[model samples]
Target chain A: MSENKKSVFNEIIRPALVLTVITLVTALCLALTNAGTKEVIKANAEKELLRSKQEILPAAEAFSEEKEEELNGKTFKYIEGTDASGEIVGYIFQNSTPGYNGPVTALVAIDTEGKIVDVNALDLNETPNVGMLVGERDFLDQFAGHSGEIALTKEKAAENEVQAVTGATISSAAFLNSVNEGLAQYAAVSGNAPEPLSPEEQACPDAAEFSEEKTVEKDGNTYTYKEALGEDGSLIAYIIRTESKGYHAPVIVLTAIDPDGTIQGTATVDLQETPNLGSKIGEEEFMQQFVGKSSEISLGTLSDTSVEAVSNATISSKAFVDAVNQALELFPLVSGGAS
Target chain B: MSTDKAKVKEVFTRGLIRENPIFRLVLGMCSSLAVSTTLIGALGMSVSVLVVLICSNIVISLLRNFIPNTVRIPAYITVIAGFVTIVQMVIKAFFPEIDGLLGIYLPLIVVNCIILGRAEAFANKNGVLISALDGLSMGLGYTIAMISIAFIRELLGSGTLFGVQVIPASIPPIMLFALPAGGFLVLGILMAVCNRIAEHFGQPKAELGCDSCAAYGRCPAKEFEASQDEAQTDADRKIRKAGARAKRNEEDRK
Candidate 1:
């Protein structure tokens, strides 16, 4: 009986013993390799943050964080930048305000004399075309060198006045509010009060003329007090609305044309399309194609001539064309036949 | 064949293919799925499995003489866990990324049925040399299977195989293949395909002829054969004795 048991051990138990040894050896080698590659990964993350800061404040040679303070019941950071001789070059103030979607944050650069330098949208969670108007260079450039109370309107009542991007009324308002908030904080820290608004500057011309007491009728579209004021205001430079069955949903665009017919601003204030792929229509490149085009230009002709769809993003491109056509139709009415 | 050199060579060759751990024995499927997402990850997992397998097998085989039959499984587990902890600490200090990726799966190798199964069954009864060979082959077989699956999934899903793009830009790469669903789908297809290939190649089934074998009895196989032989002889004697008794009864009646 004992002899029989010995053979069983040789056949069954022996092979199992061999497998265990192989597993143990392999595990030891793997553990060694894993211990070698950790630092490289951490360094890569730090490099990315520095690159983003450089992109936004490219001119400033150096950057330093300022003390945190409360304004309008919200916390903000005042980041100061300096030149080679220790002179203050400019200041990057971080400010946030409630936007259409959520809080929008911006790094507003102000010169030593309290004049606006530039503004970079650090983090914004808002509708693409509607809320993105604040990022436009033309809209933000209006704030440069401005010191007094500012309001967004088409009328040139003061040098500090900023023209709102048409069709993105809410986003424009948010931008004005954040700029005001930033200036207010700067004043409180520097122990000075911001310059008061003048009589003409205080009243929004478009809002005053389009008051609730009066209404206007044009081409079967009823224009009310505020809505009519939006048209009369320089903010509503050009408005166009186009429709095409080619799109999955209706594409509506309201483009603000500068006096020279260049697309100073644009907003896809209304659109329901696929996320990411189709939604890229809200991107800069897509909007840049319309920058210099006139409101009268037919999108159908442009589709064959100028505007081209991004590769693999056909649905979004067609939707953009549809919205562009709609904007073109409303141009004469919104611009008061100026175009 | 009688020399020590010949015995070691025979043992080493058996693990390479004839008794492959993954293909033939079908063991260690947990880490096989978890770390096979990338080739580098698979390589790391393979090395770890090999180290643990070889060390535990060698230790268990050496201690086979002293281990009691009833307490053997517990003893084997303790040895395997010790090596795994050492590997884990060394990895955490040196390679944090891979260490982070492997995470809990590394220590889980201690309970992996393949490791403990081997220690309890083979190493406990075999010589150290044979046990080590078994560990090497099984580990290699598992590694090969894991990398192959990862390669196919990464290529189809991301247009990259092992992080290098293989597909052209014109083709819309299928993203779903990199997800968790793709892992199971790829593994299932690979397993079925392996079985089909084995069948087509006419490989001998490992579990055949166990019944009536001596290995099932005292020797497991020896007693099984002995029982069969005894039954046959008893039947033969009965047939002859019955015939003789019938003939004698016929003579008496006449």
Candidate 2:
């Protein structure tokens, strides 16, 4: 019996004992570390949620999550944002819609007057330079101070059509659908029945206008290069609207050019950038340098160059310059098509 | 005493260049290719690997004497996986953006060949301090390689340096560099460059196939090299010639 006991210890019992001890020690160490980090992780998630909420509902100093509410045939969660004194400030809704690439998640805020304060497209998996234009102020700012089922359009405003980004109709529609869903949910919850706009009424902006004689699509967007006729019907110059991707968002530029493709005038239509830094690209002083410059204008390359980069916002300045360069590059293609 | 110091230096410096975990040794290629698209992703993976490798190596070295030979691999894996889990949990809680970006790759570090290979080859046979040093150096080597790959990929791929735009917008960004294929391309080019530099300094040119690789046994490259050596040996050649002659003689008798 003593020999048997020694054999068991030598052969089977010892390895099992060693493995068990190692595993238990590892588990104990992991448990202790997990306990230490659990709260920190939770706090980080809450902080991000709070920041997103605050961006959409600026008047609210505090937020409380209400129970998930069902409205408009979909489930919605309303987060009530309150001021410091506990008075309700506005209602923020979390909604998502299937975008061009994947789901685009949004946080939509509604003031007490039932108008949309703003729509923040929070998490998006949309195509980077194309569908990502949904986050720009041009698209998002249009939703502000608007009430009822918000409509979208691609054509000239007909007292109803809100502009849709060129070449990214699907993304624009998906984002608008998310906003409309939030409004429907808000209406259901607050007992206010804002009339639902029919699906056909959600008009996306069109490329062709009454005066557009020639139009072509390039780089997933439509461009119409035509002569800007004077009052006497004589050809003045060429004008084109184009888009370019910046460091954080897209910037749209409407550039007018000579018939020979030299620059005439350039103005930014939509720009969402870091207020003081990247936004410096939009200053008249910075833009004026490109006024009479040729298509070959270079920044920071040649000593006697026509353009200078915005001091700290090199990327924004570059993006702005690139957009103008693209318009100049496109002039020949469009003019050739016209000839 | 001098020899001991030199030996220690060799062990530490070896992982940096001569036996780098990514470029030279070619261990842990999965995370090297997958998580190295951006600087943030690369840094996150490098730090996590550093923690797991160091902790597992120390623990395994301390327990080397008692673990049974038959169960050593399983026991080592269990230890490595535990450390990996702890790293994963801490990262998940603290760095959610990085955690989301790293996603499934963080948990996949448990199976990373470098951590397990170091345990089975070096840590189990060395002292605790030496094993710890090996882990730290190898981790640093991996970090350096990952950063180089990510820097090129992000710059050309997104026209950004560490998420800051560096490349002016005049040049169109090559979006392919941000993808997985770009990771492989950058790694190959970087490896070739490193080999060229090493050759210039009189160090041996880096070997390309797996036979000379330092992973645990059963390497196909190693097996192929062993067979080639056997064919080249005088005795093996003589024996094959004699066997052929014997077969011919038997046929003549028939």
lDDT of 2 by residue, A194-265 (tens): 565321111101112223546767778777554565556555566666667887898777666766766766
lDDT (Cα, tens digit) per residue for candidate 1, span B82-142: 7777666666655655675687789888887778867865788898888987677666666
Indicate which candidate wins on TM-score: 2
Model 1 misplaced regions, further than 4 Å: A1-339, B2-18, B196-254
Q: Which of the numbered candidates is closest to the native, going by highest DockQ? A: 2
Per-candidate fnat, comma-separated: 0.00, 0.58
| Residue A20 of model 1, lDDT score | 59
DockQ of each: 0.02, 0.29
**Interface RMSD (Cα, Å) for model 2:** 2.6
Worst 10 residues of 1 chain B by lDDT: B211-220
